[model samples]
Target: MAKYTEEEIRNFKKITCKIAGDYLGVSSMAVSIGMRNDLLPIGFAIKKDDDRYSESWSYHIVDERLIAYKHGKINELQIQNIEKNLNTIIEQFEEMKKDLLFILSEDVD
Candidate 1:
């Protein structure tokens, strides 16, 4: 991955998945999946449920975190913190999923 200066990254109105993926020499889907799975600490990946059968992903990357991740500056402590946060998010998502399922089942009945 090539290192990007803060100024260069700040110039972008939005740091999209494609832009980040290009810098990291990976496809946009790879970037999205990485972020979703908490393997990449460069950004936030939110999965949006558009309907019962469709979902889409949205990403919001922190410029500083992207630069730090690209430059290999993310410390072990930060990684641990990210993991902790990821776990919490997973738990919350599970709860939300269960609630949605219950609501849908009621509609089906």
Candidate 2:
């Protein structure tokens, strides 16, 4: 994990799988799989509600998860998990990104 200041962590108001992917130049599916398999940090922001299907969550990659992934810190299983067809992965990633944005904004007036 990367050491981050309190304000630095809070400054990351909108980190997500896709955003992490963007930072690392990989598909969001890769970040998602890494998180699901515990191969990477689950990020700073978390879901307030248990309903994953609901637009109710938050996230901030205040660690080296993205850099780790980029540097080949992931394992074979993680590689396989993110090896989906490019089109499907990109589409799904986009939708998920939108959903996460919605979740993050649900409380803001």
Candidate 3:
């Protein structure tokens, strides 16, 4: 992958899985799996439960982070921070899920 400039990276609102996989010379599934497992530092992969037994993944790739990761510029500290933030987000999501469940169970006249 070529080194992208700040302006070029800034032009993207969010990088799609296909685009990221193409840049990294991997399949979209590989990218998704990597993000889902926290192996990729470029973005987030949120698992969305569609039904009782089915689920899908949603990706949100930060362009700046992707560029930094592609160029090997992300340090261990940055990766640790990213993991910490990801954990916080997961906790918040779990709380939101609980709130939604409670709201749905409430009786309304």
Candidate 4:
């Protein structure tokens, strides 16, 4: 697994909000509001392909240094590991078995 530096994570967040606001039809401020109100769920903002029903990427910064990625559930121990600069947060960073759709799509659908 590739470990992302803090700077990379910041850039990724900027890009994510841009994608969400420009293409996903939601403003970055709106996303922030949602998060403040416990509305953004995982603090994830994403752009999706309606035709394919697929996500590009989605994320939420659990803290100043940690981000939870698309299509996977982040665990507490994993978060701690990342805080310790362990690079790889979990045994698996991405999972194919669990459907994030059923969980996250309630905001959209």
Instruction: State TM-scores per candidate.
Output: 0.63, 0.36, 0.62, 0.26
**What are the lDDT scores of the predictions, listed in order?**
0.84, 0.60, 0.80, 0.46
TM-score of 1: 0.63
Q: Return the TM-score for candidate 2, rounded to 2 decimals.
A: 0.36
Candidate 1 lDDT, 1-109, residue by residue in tens? 5544578787888999888887777888889999999888887889888767878778998887888888899954797898799999999999999999999999998
Measured by TM-score, how close is model 3 to the native structure?
0.62
Clashing residue pairs found in predicted model 1: none
Best model per lDDT: 1
- Candidate 3, poorest ten consecutive residues by summed lDDT: 1-10
> In model 2, which runs have C-alpha deviations exceeding 4 angstroms?
1-11, 42-60, 63-109
Q: What's the lDDT for candidate 1?
A: 0.84
**Model 2 clashing residue pairs (backbone):** none
Q: Model 4 — which ten-residue stretch has the worst lDDT? A: 62-71
Give Cα distance to truth, residue 41, candidate 2, Å.
Answer: 3.4
